[model samples]
Target: MHLVHLTASTLFGGPERQMLGLAEHLPGEYRSSFLTFRENGRCQAFLDEVRQRGFAGEKLRADFPKVRSVLRELTDRLAAMRADVLLTHSYKPNILGRVAARRLGIPVVAVSRGWTWENWKVRQYERLDRLNLRYLDRVVAVSEGQAQKVLAAGVPADRVSVIHNGSRVADFQTPDPGFDTKLHSFFPADTSVSHVVLSAGRLSPEKGFDVLIEAAVHVLRRCPTTGFVHFGEGVERERLEAIIRERGLTGRFVLKGFTTDLDRFLPWSDLVVLPSHTEGLPNVALEASAAGVAVVATAVGGTPEVIADGETGRLVPPGQPEQLADGIAALLADDRTRMAMGRAGRLRMQSRFTFAAQAAAYQKLFASLGSPTVFLQERVTCQQPPSPPSPEDRNAPTRPGRFGSPTSSTT
Candidate 1:
């Protein structure tokens, strides 16, 4: 199978990693390539990674406001590659790729990561994306929670398949010798921070970085030696900076812009935090578990699915700084419990979320596209909930799933 993924990636982030990881782990018969919109020069990072991974990648010259040109380019490229299937990521690709793929009689699948809804402009785009998903041959929701959202948006349930994001555990198995020295370098030379609290995501309003800052104020009051570090950058930087200054967290709370080497530093942190208001199986959470670092994140989206509260990490309500602070502070005070949780988290990732399994799921989905009867059978098979956890693994208290009861698939 010749698979081509179309995306409008402004930076090489989680979704980008998932795409490359799937390609790298898939069976040899499946050839994968990537096509990205030229977001000025920002698409270079992703395209470069694609090349490093020995996959063909192209940056599309035609973009939005030039629908006809984009469709022509897509159709021409798909034909040239003889792509068997076209997979799209994000709103722009979902809207345009569907039309182009239809012109070529190729199956098109849209990977539905939850919307950020960062601003008015993004909200409008997401509205159109929700509408467009119904027409796609398939919609792959990264989380079961997101799959529900897709169903709610009028897409047939049979067309939506839930595939949880996988973690690259091998990347975090070994610690970098100089990671500690490099991490501490970000703080003041005189600062005597004993424990580091780390968080990473796009610095946007929907990510709830402001809520994290508020929680940090309370956490610092109890654990004064804990310093907070955030990775990634976006429009919310200035506002977050102003909030930091106002809270007198000058050097204490730092925003170290986007970095491709986050895995290098992840295992070195004492704890990982994700304060997003929404998510679709966040890679940061999965990566943290792979790094054996306990996370204290908001119970939203697919987070509860990844975080077995009290087993792997604690789950707090979204936008509640006091509760978030309590979770962080309580974990920080007890080193033994936190370390145990981290170990459990790593085991969970190893047993459940792996690229090999994700690749197999995709392979089944791709193979089924050739027959309508097989496709429907595949959908039914993929929708069945996961088997119950083993008795030994059921020690942790189960929290009610935010998006109804958690669902999973053999796929």
Candidate 2:
């Protein structure tokens, strides 16, 4: 089967890693390729990595607002590749890929990660994405929590599937010999930092980095030698920096920007923290578990499904800096308990969040969509059955509470 993944990638982050990992682990019978929208020139990073991994990747010349041009290009590309199924990532791809796949008579599936709702424009795009979900052949939610949101958007239960993100455990097994030297380079030469607490993700509002900076102030009061370092970069960098200055956390709290080698430093940290207000089974939490480091994260989205409170790590309410600080300080204070939790987290990741298991689930999903030859023959022979009418076609109401009430609890 030739699987084509359609995405509008700006950077090579968690979702990009997930795509590469899936392609690497799939059986030889399945050939995976990538198509990305050129976000000016930002899509090059992901496309470069795709080529380095021996996968076919292309950057579309047309972008959003050029809907007709994009559709024409996508139709030609999919027809040329004879793609079996198309898997879309975020809002732009989901909306456009569905229409393009329909033109080619190929099944298109959308991977529904949770919405960030960062700003006015993004929220509007996500609203359109929600409306677009009901027309796709299938919707794959990254977590059970997100699956509820998919159904709430008017997609039938029969068309939804939950597939958790997998951890690349092997990537974290080997220790970098120069890790200590690299760590010391991030801080001043005169400073003596005893422990490090690391966080990584796009530095956006939904990531809650500002909340993390607030929590660091309280944690430093309790464990003065403990320093906080963050990875990844986005629009919130200036705001987070301002918070660090206001809290007098200069040098103590640092934003290290985005790095592709996060795994090299992940296992060296004393603890991993995820302060996101929303997520779709966060890859940072899974990677931390694979690195044998405990996590302190908000109990939002699929995070609780990854971190077992008081066992693997601590779970606190989102946007609560004091509670988040308490969780970090308490863990930092108890070395034995923290180390034990790390070990348990590593075991949990090995058993539940392996790439092998994730690939198996995707394999099942693809098999249900039918074989490549069968779909091609059906299209060529004009024997394809008519698709059932969508909710929009019947003029059915698909308001927020149409299917069921949204759950109040995060877990």
TM-score for each predicted model, relative to the true structure: 0.91, 0.91
Off by over 4 Å in 1: 371-411
Candidate 1 per-residue lDDT, tens place, 1-411, comes to 899999998888999999999999998999999999999989999999999989999999999899999999989999899888899999999999988877666778899989999899999999999888877878888887787677667675556677778888888878996987788778897878888899999988989999999999999999998889999999999999999999999889999999888998899899999988999889999999999999999999889889999999999999999999999999999999999999999999998999887888888778767843443455456544234334443333323222221223422
Q: What are the per-residue Cα lDDT tens digits for candidate 2 across 82-114?
A: 898999999999999988887787888898888
Candidate 2 versus the native: TM-score?
Answer: 0.91
Residue 47, candidate 2: Cα error in Å is 1.4
Q: How far is candidate 2 from the true structure (C-alpha RMSD, Å)?
A: 4.7
Assess each prediction's global lDDT (C-alpha) against the native.
0.86, 0.86
Candidate 2 stretches greater than 4 Å from native: 371-411
Q: Please give the clash total of every predicted structure, in order.
A: 0, 0
Error of 2 at 63 (Å): 1.1
